[model samples]
Target: MSVTDEPLLSVDGLQTSFYTEEGEVKAVNDVSYQIDRGERFAVVGESGAGKSVTSLSLMRLIDDPGRVKGGDVTFRSTSAVATLARKFPEGVATENSPGYIHVTELRSESGAVGSDPGATVRDNPTDVATSLHDGSLHIEAGHVDVLDASEDAMRELRGNEIAMIFQDPHTALNPVYTVGEQIAEAIRKHLEMDDGAAKERAIEMLERVGIPDAEERYSDYPHEFSGGMQQRAVIAIALSCDPALIVADEPTTALDVTIEAQILDLLKELSNEEDVAVQLITHDLGVVAELCDSVMVMYAGKPVERSSVEELYYEPKHPYTVGLMSSIPRIGDDRERLDTVPGTMPDLVQLPSGCSFHPRCPYAEDACLEHEPPLVDVETGEPVEDPDPAVHSAACLEYTGELQDGVDFDVQIREDAATDGGESV
Candidate 1:
């Protein structure tokens, strides 16, 4: 698992939603991004902005009523090819290694992707390995939609290949189990180590995460540890396996500034030492400024902008991003009240027809109210269904010059607090 130039993870046209008594609530709209091996990618947005949901969807942790409707989550791995080879002992005929697996695990019941008439994946050997034979997937470069894998395969993939750190360490941890026991459980289950070895490794991980007196603390229950200590334990469990990708859902939100810094620094260290990729989900742009290589801004469940962290903060192109920056307090600000977007996030179930943020955008015009703009390169502003995730892009009519009276980002900034460290936010 050495880091390579090729992308380790790529998500395309991802859409996840919840089915309610009223209707389908699009929690995560057509979001797409790709992260390279060992990269720290940040997804920033206010609460209910689908930041957490996106991560949860990637982990396939969406509970009943919430389903990942449309999307492909591809992860590069040679081991995954072996996993597929084992899963499709009879049906799949792979020419190349399964270098990438679409971890979503498309179910055989998800219609065409897995249950095709010619390639139906059935329990019996007589059945076609239809799950891996998605007409399009030849398994070259190991790119196979994981949505086609079985639950058993997905289980093996979770802690071993992909891991997650929840927002609240207390809730994520089992109250009845000791901190070390839980870590050992994960180790034993994923790594298949014996109890004695697993416990020893768990202690080693605890110490690695800066836990003091690791052996003694191994017997301490979750309630016994302080808030910061609990978070450290969570990180210990997450990193114990050295997963290829770790989706950290606001990992530092519950900690104090000092602890937050320590946790962030620890994550940075692990990213380098372990060569693990991280998808850091948080609303704090300051944290993104500190830890991430690239940033994606989400609004009302849709990606409004994405770019390198410097470009995102220093030269934001979307109006929503500008509004978010205006809300952040700067040192020389003279305004009596803090700047905030005029309106709150729209109700997901009853989202406006066109651009969801049009109501709150000062530059919004008739066109914006009628037709939502696709995310596009700010320089070209040409409408693109799926813009390059690595390039600077935004979803706004102004980018395409549709709005005659386009947004003047200057209006959102004060004279002295205009840029952050000479960057645009």
Candidate 2:
């Protein structure tokens, strides 16, 4: 899709929570973004930063205690609307289709029954057509929202339109079934091929992912294959349906450095070859810089900053982003102490009253504790030359002009006064 075009998937105000025995844990909170066709989007954060939850919400795969509270996920197709209209007419509707909405016309037998008489017949048609054309028709294309679709409809779209490669290949793959059988099952289910054809296709996919002796290894169990092989098998299964979008949730987490590099290369190659958009979820900044077109730095279940991978690595905006970048160990640095972000993640059940990261942020002031800062355009008001208004954003009181003139050094003063016989500054 072109730069001016609507995103293939757009998520707005997404909130997901789980009702635990202790309390409701907000896994994801009002997270939003847009993914263009064939773009590599990465969600980078520490573990439990809601990266996986976001992906699960997109697939409607959250179950049991987890539930989506509020959100709008809108998906736009790259294919022309005329083509989709041809395949499925304006008035036509399918019961099992996830994003299918029907438009009904009421024909009055008598002209006397005129409701909203001032409105022209053309106006009503236009409104209804617009709603049908753009408002409701959404199917999740990977992490993108396919709108107006029910659970059943989403199931149909899941593997066919959007596929996922989970973090753990061993658990994700069926232990009892042969590797070939599992792949063939996915192929048969999504591709609607017969048993023989599905098996053949499965073998072809294994070969495509660089699994040696594909035909021989198809019948091997999950335990029989090595970690790298299992991961490759999982990739083969995820790509079997030729989905438009793929969610790789730390696909390299379980592998060695060499294997991880190989897997990353493989994914990159597949993304280019198949023209499929990828969402890579990981905490590794190096991986984000290497593979992602755009990077979203999340903290406390919220995106603290977002920018192009290059900009984010080279010129981070938020203090949290800067801290994360600084935490990355250098190859030849001989410093006694490596820089580290202070404090642990706050309890999601009872988050801080104001900015969630304020407790850990060294630059935080009293204003940060008074109220949460809104994510906004930094350049319009500030005299400082900010690059790419849309590309960078930070949710911090320091950037929002709410910071106090002087730093609040209460903790440092207390420590100093206790250690030395000096009055607190």
RMSD (CA, angstroms), candidate 2: 10.1
Residue 208 lDDT in candidate 2 = 88
Q: Which ten residues in a row have the lowest lDDT in candidate 2?
A: 135-144
Per-residue error (Å), model 2, residue 247: 0.5
Give the per-residue lDDT digits (tens) of candidate 1, residues 351-391.
Answer: 99789999998888899889888888899987555545567
TM-score of 1: 0.85
Query: Which residue runs does candidate 1 get wrong by more than 4 Å?
Result: 1-3, 83-141, 384-387, 411-425
Native-structure RMSD, model 1: 7.2
Residue 84 alpha-carbon offset, candidate 1, angstroms: 5.3
Counted clashes in each candidate structure = 15, 6
The whole-model lDDT of each prediction reads 0.78, 0.69
